[model samples]
Target chain A: MAPNGVNGSSGSHRFDPDFTRLVVENMGPNVAPRTRQLLGGLIRHIHDFAREVELTNDEWMAGVHFINSIGQCSTSIRNEAHRVSDILGLESLVDEIAHKLVVEGDVEPTSSSILGPFWSPNAPFRDLGSSIIQDPNPKGRVALMHGTITDLLTGKPIPGAVFDIWQASANGKYDFQDPENQTPNNLRGKFRADENGKYWFYCYHPTAYSLPTDGPAYKLLQLMERHPMRPAHIHIMVTHPDYRGCTTQLYPKDDPWLATDTVFAVKNDLVVDFKPKEGDPKATLDLEYNVILPPKDYKGKL
Target chain B: MAPNGVNGSSGSHRFDPDFTRLVVENMGPNVAPRTRQLLGGLIRHIHDFAREVELTNDEWMAGVHFINSIGQCSTSIRNEAHRVSDILGLESLVDEIAHKLVVEGDVEPTSSSILGPFWSPNAPFRDLGSSIIQDPNPKGRVALMHGTITDLLTGKPIPGAVFDIWQASANGKYDFQDPENQTPNNLRGKFRADENGKYWFYCYHPTAYSLPTDGPAYKLLQLMERHPMRPAHIHIMVTHPDYRGCTTQLYPKDDPWLATDTVFAVKNDLVVDFKPKEGDPKATLDLEYNVILPPKDYKGKL
Candidate 1:
């Protein structure tokens, strides 16, 4: 007898409709259930896409060549695949799906956003309220950013929540992208909330910037006639030993590209105002935001 | 006022249901009409797939990394992207869709098949009845393959139709794959039909072979619990000046893997019998087949 899940006996496979079924059936029996489901869905959808387009052989070969060129263009410093995902807005879509809030009782979870490609694991640890900007003569407006991490269920501060933050400089470049002047760990830092769950940092206000357009990603954008600009934003990942972690971005209100972020990462709840300081000349701007975390006992969607 | 195909005002673009539309709208104005249709369909389907799967951020990242790895593994000699397409049976699907016969006025077209990856443009030109096998003491059964190229409309022989043929050795390896022993262009030749539309050549009977399993394509098959073997077949491309070219393969009728060709390239019409030579002891087997071509004026779905 034929094995379970095998579409038909070996002799019965045909090209019309059975070909797809045969391809799916031939998948290894040992594949994990989730993997099987994902692969099956992917294959089915891909086949449907091909059929819907009535994809010609020349078009198929063109796609193959395009993918190969994407591969050829990738390197240690340049990730063409990641750029492709960004250009397609798939990364943001995945983020949105993966981080849906599941409310329990009265708890309200903080919104999550895209953890963009600029994140580095080596951000320096700094004291709360310390300046993250190391450059003495920075070109952008200085901002004081303050926030508190609290447990949504208990409505109490999470005293020791750690915040990993990074953002682009005034000239719209990350530290690694501008090695000529910016020192290591510039505009990136790790800090812990105080006993009152308060955290603050001084940094330059991030400026909106265009994505790298020299590679396949840019080529795609050019083909799409789409602008590659990302709105001004600061990235942060908040984590606590007892609560679920959150990776998000704080978009500045009124940014021209806010609605048209090339990566499609903006969320209304994640937008914040970067208000100009009223009295302090030294502080060019101030931002007050808060983060709410799910409790350790919470068992809901991330 | 917005441009012709722009979905909305610049500031109105959002990430909810509108994101997909924005992406489709942003496609460059100069894109060919067909390309726009294809890309638009692709973006919609990809977005739909992500939504259907509820693709997680981690899963998305994993896919990105996987694609990058496939790219990194590609070289001048190996195309991992094409291998992935083959393993997914995408290549065969494209072939099926692309080579559909567009019949006109009782014209019968030759069956088309997948163009397997081993074909090289460097096959040496040889006269009709030439021996493609250069290995003096080849260890496989010697076979005499003869074919006729005819016009589908007239059913008359089309003289001077060029045929490019290639196949693996009995050891299930191609000349390029067994460079340590096999000479360049072994079992590969370019021949033309005579005035009577007859062509013949001698070669070893091909053996079923496994695809290269060290790459991502094989890894996927292994995960799917599928074998990577392609059925024994001879690759052929016949082209006449007045006809549309035909790229196809002739599968042995009794090959064990014919029913389960790893690439799903097998079709009943493309299968031919490899009969044992009745009287000639020198020729172990013989294959007689004919090819039909559509006139250049014939234009249909394919």
Candidate 2:
């Protein structure tokens, strides 16, 4: 029989008596209620995992050392812990849980997606429809993208919504990754919607890219015999005074890796077509998308 | 309905569809069978815990940053990750699982305990019955501890058994912790058993001590309103050519924190009395203990 509070209807295994007690009652009296709850569940699950596998001492030590190495590998330029989480699908999982659709009456909130590891707070704000690809020797077809932001419940345009947009170049490199070839803030821009709640930008077509392979995250991927590619996509974050902020990504519909993105951030609703344009001399492709945001007064559990 | 391959009889919670798929099918084709099994259960439990609490994005980010800080806090002299595991009761749990008692034909094995974080591999060797407390101004009552190592199955002396012993000073400090006052290897010694499996050592009585409070581990303790004291005990590791190695600790019977040791390393069978001696010229107290070891051929699951 399983020990009391060990399995506790959340697992189907028995544990040593002392371990069970430690997991069930180790919390101190002064811990906040929410902290207590979070820790209790975390402890139980970790203990259960150990028991389920009958983990050896050497294995446990290896895990300890692995965590230490990850710490040692981190620097201001790289976050190995975040990379580990991304490869393990934890970041995507957290995003899905924290940003579930908010329903107020009959309105549907915009779909949420991964913030990924490349977001920068210093993206330069630009005028509407300005070219974000400032490099003299750009490598991809030019595209015109436009989007509008609206309040979900009121169906009214949220004028002056700020849109922060960024993506990899056609060569699958972000600005930071190719400092010698790409100017600072290349392929990254922040634009404000006009009085009609519509915003537009000119940039090169984004492409699929593999994560850095020299790091521990990619090493794990190699060990698992898995790919490191994220799908062709563009990232966008919209914010307005009267609405809750929305951070999301837009994937090309025809990208072969859409269903198998290593980060698991893709959703069917977030995929769009990059259609060919006929009448623009400076742009070869055009795409249109719209976003809906929850009202600031929305009171709903996430 | 619960998703397939997720919490399938092991847990009692529902998960987001994508999260469930990631937990169930995230392993790659090249992953070892054992690794796949371990990771499957681990992913499932982590997801369940997140869903159970509706973990917020801020909380998730906080956890990520906390882990990174633990990594950054580590050094050659300190392992903050290990310290975190120790305070969370994970080290004790792993010890209990890895060092289970071994029972052979008609023989009961000796009880095992934690090796703790203070052990050093550079202890000096000494003759039988040597005084380990070489400090000229020792601060506590002197004690003589003697023990015999015998084969559990036959109750016969195990010749040439080596005993490695260490303990904190009466002032509740280890040699390394007070280098300004204590010699390099004070209070640490190794001795070999006689033909009769007998060994003895002289040392000062140990007192309960608190862990370092300035690091992240103790900061967590403070936040949880928990004390950081470990019960008074002497650490020992016994090894013989014809028997498996045993690492354990012996606790005094009268320690105030015996039942509430912060590390939870105390076992009922490992606690002993420290009796006062009437006329010991070199000692004020005496304690006698015995250890039983399984034969070299003993085979048991841990």
The candidate that achieves the highest DockQ relative to the unseen native structure? 2
lDDT of 2 at B290: 88
**In model 2, which residue pairs have backbone atoms overlapping below 3 Å?**
A10-B11, A11-B10
DockQ of each: 0.37, 0.43
- State the RMSD for candidate 2: 3.4
Model 2 clash count equals 2
Question: Which of the CAPRI classes, incorrect, acceptable, medium or high, describes model 2?
Answer: acceptable
lDDT of 1 by residue, A69-168 (tens): 7877888878889889887878877886666666756656888888877899999889987888886445788889998999878889999899999988
Stretches > 4 Å off in candidate 1: A1-15, A102-108, A153-156, A296-302, B1-16, B102-108, B122-124, B299-302
**First chain TM-score, candidate 1:** 0.90
Query: Interface RMSD values for the candidates, listed in order?
Result: 7.2, 3.2
Please give the lDDT score at residue A270 for candidate 1.
86
